[model samples]
Target: MHRTAPRLARILACAAVPVMLVASGCSSDSDGKPKAEKSQKSEKTDKAGSSGGAALATPESEKKPAVAPVKFTKLPEACRSLKPKTIEKLVPSTKAKAGTPGRSTDLLTRGSCSWNGLDDNGVKGSQYRWLDVSFLRFESDAALGTSGKQRAQEAYTKEVAKNRATTGAKNVKAAPSAGVGEEATALSYQLRKTGEDFSYVTIVTRTDNILITLTYNGTGYAGAKPPAVADLLKDAVPAVKETVTSVTAANK
Candidate 1:
């Protein structure tokens, strides 16, 4: 009985060795670090940042974004934007004083009109004239894509350059126009059309997202003198200013 008791005590002590090693947190790593401590450090690093030492990437919803607003909601009528006297002066002896409208799928985005006339005086002489007006509008919508004013500004530059590059143009001149709109450009030149040397003046202006292009040209045939460029410019300024005003009026 005494030998059996002693043997049982030895066996219990040997079994407790493994429990002691586990409680002490023994591991194969040579750094002397407990397995639990190593696991804790690894977990913290996985979190990327937790102690304010480093920050996570910013979320899109929290970042600052670019934005631009567009003014004016619609465009004016292409044919009625100009006054009766203005039309008469631009296109003398007109077939239709109301002007001819262009095809447009969306008036809020674009509109245009044109007029041409020949004033006949038989043996005295014959005078010819032509006029055109176009308006383009844009909207600042994220869904529709891009900024409205930016698009119009690009179009404004393109249109002005195109007019100044007219084929077979003579004495072409360019200058900034004032008191017309937010910004405007005037291009004057001479072109032989309708069997006469016609004076051409194109006024390109913009107000917000809307671009206004006004062209006035006149020529003389059968010994008649073409109209002065200065006179045409003077008349064009008022007519263009009125068109810009009409855009503002349409929105109001």
Candidate 2:
């Protein structure tokens, strides 16, 4: 009986050893605080990705308001009558040539006028005339130089500056005009008023002394209520520049 009692005591001690080890492991952290851990990189990556996605989701409609179309009408006889004098004032040096009256695609009855004379820089010049009474629009100058291409550029620059000053243009920038063919170059200054009107003056020159100055001006139409004239000028300037550039290229 004594031998059996000793063996049973050994067996009980062996079973209690495992329970003690498990209890010690579970209760090791007596302060009840969670283990400190390093920050996860995946969380930062996810945040950065979400921010970038948000930045790219902006819509185009929010960037700019739509512009309204322009309402147009025929120029009254009084308006048409002033055209000759106005053209003379606008281009004083050139001699007026006879013009043909006609209808244009933009819904204006236009009278064409032309002239030949020396440019501001003393270059020989010739110009085509276009006067639209309804919009009070005129484009009547085409010029070339006896001085040289560089002189032509200088003359045109001066002319553009003078026109801008005369018209009280605001928010102006130099831009490309339409090319005539492949070689003729063109450029212009676009002008706009914040809420009033749009207009532009373009200067196109070739390697030859040919310099062409074109001025465009207009108010807004019905469904397309004219934006601030200034904003329209801003938009029109660049467009006219592109057209002049193309024309230059074509002329080449």
Candidate 3:
């Protein structure tokens, strides 16, 4: 009986050892759950912040331009650009000597002015004259692969082509002008308009981004003669230069 009792007690002690081990493992799992969950949440937050920071690192809207900024911003007043001597010689009998300004929404981009007059000689001859000037400013555009000067050059060629394409024009001639701005072209032709033969002198010039255009035209009234092309071109050079100078003056 004594031997049986000792063996049973030993069996009971071994059974209690397994139960205590199971309890200890359950307590470890319970203590680790909150820490594991907290670690997972921290990892997720870190990943989300990393992704958001990457998106803000680079901005697509900041594009660099290929060229420098243009020098001239505003253009000179077209009509007022011409010198007084030029206006006087071009339109001697101008009714409004102050000159009339052309229409434009933005003077910085473009502007123009003109004058016209008639010197009436009863029973002899009458002379009629007209003069006008125009100015245009160009800006650099990197997208188009053109600087301010290049854009102005294209416009210069276009303006010359436009003058050459004049319909019903007679004796149309285009020649490069010297000693005026960076480059210039003189277009002279004879066009009959309003029952009168008129001589046209157009000068398209460019200095930097600014384009200058000077036009001088005249007709004879009551048995008069047309103005000579040579004389008109000689007088037109300085007038165009004066207009160009006005641009530099404004910039200064």
| RMSD to truth, every model | 4.5, 20.4, 5.9
Q: Residues 82-110, candidate 1: write the lDDT tens digits.
A: 98898887778998898999999998899
Give per-model TM-scores: 0.78, 0.28, 0.75
User: Which candidate number would show the highest TM-score if scored against the true structure?
Assistant: 1
lDDT of 3 by residue, 41-60 (tens): 88999999999999878654
User: 1-252 in candidate 2: lDDT tens per residue?
Assistant: 999999999999999999998876575445543233113445677889999999988786565543322222232222233334444543334444332234455423222223333223223222222222111222222232123434434655665455545555565555444443113222233344656344443333222333333343433322233224344334433433343343334334
Best by lDDT: 1
- Residue 150's lDDT in candidate 1: 82
Q: Worst lDDT window (10 residues) for model 1?
A: 48-57
Model 1 lDDT, residue 145, Cα:
54
Q: Flag clash pairs in model 3.
A: none
lDDT against true structure, model 2: 0.40
